[model samples]
Target: MSESKRMDPFTGEKVEVDGVYENEAGQEEELHRGDAFPADLILGNTEWKLTEMSFDNHHEGRTDERLVPKEKDIDKQGKIDSPRRQMDRGKK
Candidate 1:
């Protein structure tokens, strides 16, 4: 048996592992866009070392202008915004 480790749902591009405990078995998964990645590793009890690791780019992040509502579109609570179109003056 070993101590439990906590990890963030999202992973960064870089990772630094400290040490592994004995009989440590776990699985780490990173989801991005429409892609799915699964990773499995067995941690050693000796020293802090990265045994089995992998990186996957799911590319699930995005910004859709259509999803954004206008100022008036939303109520006072700010839940939604109005869809009024605001025209910008032509400038050189």
Candidate 2:
């Protein structure tokens, strides 16, 4: 087993890692996007190594703006946002 330190992007802390790790697993993934990706490896622990990537530009990540409610739509507690809550509020 090998030992290494990696910076945690979320917590901004030093993370200690043990075992054989792929330090440059997705090195090409940063340079590539969607279908234009260069070959990158998604290594697994003694199980697999994924060197091929297939991407579809037709189905990108997008959240419908209609699904997102405005800040005014949600009350202070954020629980009174839906139509059901509006009805409940009218009863009160």
Candidate 3:
């Protein structure tokens, strides 16, 4: 089977899932799949917030049973880290 992949938030590597990588500062960081995004991993230059999201639930009398909890943060439109901080995130 093809390996699943996700870009390392710190190094921008489209690495295979469950792999480990070194940062620009030579810090070893492990990668995983199926986990919530880490807000702290985002350097201090990005804007992120919880936007209301929902799913259609037709089985429970057409009522939405679960509003996604607020543990995850979605990036605000066009919000991104500055090049300087993006560089810092990869440093020791």
For this target, which candidate reaches the highest lDDT against the unseen true structure? 3
Q: Is candidate 1 or candidate 3 better by TM-score?
A: 3
lDDT of 3 by residue, 1-92 (tens): 34355333433323334444444344444545443333335352222222222233454545342432233546433333344533345548
lDDT per residue as tens, model 1, 1-92: 34367433222223343222112244323333333222334332212223444333324545455566555664444334444444456984
Candidate number with the higher lDDT (1 or 2) = 1
Q: Which ten residues in a row have the lowest lDDT in candidate 1?
A: 15-24
Model 2, span 1-92: residue lDDT tens: 33355331211222232112223343322222222222223442222122444444426556555555566764444444466655343544
- In model 3, which range of ten residues has the least summed lDDT? 45-54
Q: In candidate 2, which residue ranges exceed 4 Å CA deviation?
A: 1-26, 29-62, 74-92
C-alpha positional error of residue 21 in candidate 3 after TM-score superposition, expressed in Å? 1.7
What is the C-alpha local distance difference test score of each model? 0.35, 0.34, 0.38
The candidate 2 region of ten consecutive residues with least summed lDDT is 10-19
True-structure RMSD, every candidate? 15.5, 13.8, 21.0
Off by over 4 Å in 1: 1-24, 30-60, 72-92
How far is 64's C-alpha from truth in model 2 (Å)? Answer: 1.3
Model 3 clash number: 0
Per-residue lDDT for 40 in model 1?
A: 31
Give the Å error, residue 90, model 3. 46
